[model samples]
Target: MEKQELFKIGDVAKMFHISVGSLRHYEKFGLLKPEYTDQETGYRYYSTRQFECLNTIRYLRVLDMPLDQIAEFLRNRDVKKIQEMLQQQKKRVVMKQNELQIIEKKIENRLQQLQDTLSSELDTVRIIQTGPRRITWIRNKLRPKSYLDLETSIRQLEKQQENTVVFPGKVGIGITKERLLKKQYETYDIVFLVLDQEDNYNGIVEELPNETSVAIRFCGSHADAPVYYAKLANFILAHKLTITGFSKEITMIDYGITNDITKFVTEIQIPVAAI
Candidate 1:
């Protein structure tokens, strides 16, 4: 009788391009066992017959199948079981693709916003027509004397939201129509998260109708907002426009985004109408 050839553990691992530790792990999980173990040396060896099982293990692992599931299938595999597993994994892959698509869109929007902010002409007030915008907001007396106060207010607003995933560049502070008329620029009456058209939120959502607005982008945050508010007020007065709604003040770039104070940019948009 002819003796069959067997490869050592290291050689088998090298053939499969996997670490020897991985083969040991598969043995520990009872997923695969070596063809033979030398009693005196306790060294492992694999016969060529075991290669088919190792190849199947590698194939399923590439599909991200859990080790326990792979072991179960290997124990009792058939065409029907493989077909079912493939369908389930396909569903998981599709779901992951959808999640990636949403993430891609958010990255694209953030990139555009940063580019627009970098190119914006600071301190120049302009009257522009804006489309209707939707926001999920919380009404609070947020006169931020410090960064902590502002952070607390944002946390409170997030708590009120059903969807707690707040994205950057979507948050804004608003001054009431009366507050703007009174020149109370430092005090904000509401904090809001502007919603994309696809966003679904179960909270205090409001739609600000399409209207003309006096807008100005500046190199500052809420702390530097009072000066820009004064500028917008002057622009509105000079143009004979009346303040019609809450002022939307959004920080395009701020400490939350970057450490550099020079990169900070904030924009204030006040809805208006011709008198």
Candidate 2:
């Protein structure tokens, strides 16, 4: 058959090393469309020229672009518009690269620290058995401009709780999935209360489950968490274990709680596969 002749879905699927189901899925998602359809046979056919278009859809989807937006862009197919979209994507990728670099650096530093700690006779690793505890905490939405406000708000909460004599656990922070995907820095909650306590501290109290593993106490600011994460990730990989959840940042020293980044000492906890 000549190159201009249309190929059936199965034919194109085989040629592209993709499953027929996948092709249908792309179509269903509005990411790809067959150039022609035989009403009688109910078969889908695509020209060879459509291969490039299909591949473009696949490539964009790999980058996590929404199919609706992809379809809109394809409909217009304006060179300038496509370039603008690509530039935006490029910015996102660059930001991700920067974050990865930061993570890599932290991991390197943590590895060295681990080696030093292990080798030093005076420095001993402790495996602490911690039970579930109830914590009273407040979750606040944090913006980049008001990042400093998070500490201030948390400190105020602590003071208010202390005055009211409410349940108190280690102050902890949580990151939402949305922030992670957008590369936006966010602090979802600053919770306080022990994990297995019966008393609810007048504030919002959350009961956290017990973590069974060695908890390393790192004395450092928020910036130190990244390094700790890197160390923890390395440790998990080295020991052939998987990190089961998002790591936790637990404040070990509050000194009556302050937002000063320099004085914050927190714990970065990661649940792992048992050795």
Candidate 3:
């Protein structure tokens, strides 16, 4: 009988660029077993015969296949099984790619919003024209007097959304036209998430058409909203503008983005038309 060449566990790990513990894990998982083990030293050794199996394991792992699935495939070892697994993994990869793209888009939008808010003239109200916006909203008399109350409302909105992705910098609280006219700034009638035109939504959606709006950006959170809302009201009154729609008060920067209170920026936009 010819002597078969064998590599020690450490040498095999180094060759494969994997940790030695990974080999032990594979053995524990019953995925792969060493070709030989010294009884006295309890050292694991692998021969060239195991190289193909290890290579297959490494390849499947790179495809993000679970160890159990890889083990099943290795045990079955058929062309049809591998083809089906590859198809299933390909679908998973495509799904992940789509999810990652959505995440990337959200990051870009958030960064752009932060830049816009930082450069904006704080506390200065202006009349600006805005295009249509789509929003998913939950109508409730939510007076977020404290941070805890605000979080509770947000969680409620999230629950209503089911699996929809809520993008930051796009959340807003609404005050009805009547409430605004009555100078009711403490109570919010609706909590809404602004959605991109391409966003997949499962809740009630409304499209707000293009209109001129009274807008102001200020350094504040929900607690500081009343002051800014009053400023918008004053601006609208001075400009002889009639409030035409619900207020869109979004906190552009908050604890979610940073903990510094001084850096907080909130914007209030209310659709208005010249009276």
Candidate 4:
């Protein structure tokens, strides 16, 4: 009989940079067994042919295949079974890819918004040309009067939807001309998230048309928005602009940048037409 080449467990572990414990685990799970064992010292050795089995195990593990499934597949080594498993994993990878892309877009927008807010002059109204946008929103007949109202309003929006957005920003508030004229600065009739035109939404969504608008970026809480709003109103009057749509109070720095509310950046935009 010819002597077959064999590898000690230590040699196999060092060669693969894998733990000997993992090889032992594979044995316990009936996935692979050592080709030879010395009874006197209870030492294990693997045949050179078993290296292919270990390679297959490592490959399946990297693909996140469950151990039990890997064991079953290895038992049969069926081409059709491997194809089906790979197909299922591919679907999961595709879903994760889409989710990552959405996250990347949000991060990019947040960075741009933070930079714009840092560079902007507070209390100065500016005219800008805006493209079309859409929003998924919560409308409240009674305006929000406190932070509790903001929380409650957001809860209402989430209550009706399959998924809720708590960290999404920039936050939007919509107020009618009547509300502003009545000095209802403490209350906002609607809160919204600006949505991508292609976003999947089944709830109340409003499409804002492309138009010229006046906007003011300022620092403070919602209670202090009237000051910036007044500045916008004055700018509109001085520039011969007419109010054309609801006012939107968007949180440029949606996350708190500092402990003080005065450090928070909020931007207010009102659609307008030249008189």
Which ranges of candidate 3 are over 4 A from the true structure? 1-4, 160-164
Q: 3 or 4, which is superior by lDDT?
A: 3
- What is residue 180's positional error in candidate 2, in angstroms? 41
Q: Candidate 4: minimum summed lDDT over ten consecutive residues — where?
A: 162-171
Model 4 residue 122 distance off true place after TM-score fit, in angstroms: 1.6
For each of the candidates, the C-alpha root-mean-square deviation to the true structure, in angstroms, is 3.0, 19.3, 2.4, 4.2
- For candidate 1, report its TM-score: 0.87
> Candidate 4 at residue 110, lDDT?
65
Local accuracy of candidate 3 as per-residue lDDT tens digits, 1-275: 12258889999999999999999999999988988898899988998889999999999999999999999998899999999999999999999999899778877877888888889898888888998888878887887754456666667667745565655577788899999999999999988888876577776778878888888888888878998888888888887889998898888887778889898888888999888
What ranges in model 4 sit over 4 Å off? 1-13, 19-50, 64-68, 141-149, 160-168, 254-262
Cα lDDT for residue 137, model 1?
A: 78
Listed in order, each prediction's TM-score against the native is 0.87, 0.39, 0.90, 0.77
> Taking the tens digit of each residue's C-alpha lDDT, what string does model 2 give over 104-166?
765565466445433533212233444675555555554322224445655655564433332
lDDT winner between 2 and 4, please give it.
4
Error of 4 at 94 (Å): 3.3
> Global CA lDDT of candidate 4, please?
0.76
Tens digit of per-residue lDDT, candidate 4, span 153-268:
66765565554344434457788877665546656777777775335555777787897889988776566687787778878888888888778876666434555665677788
Query: Considering TM-score, where higher is better, how would the candidates rank from best to worst?
Result: 3, 1, 4, 2
Worst 10 residues of 2 by lDDT: 162-171
What TM-score quantifies how close candidate 3 is to the native fold?
0.90
**Winner by TM-score between candidate 3 and candidate 2:** 3
**Residue 36, model 4, lDDT:** 89
lDDT of the candidates, in the order given: 0.85, 0.57, 0.85, 0.76
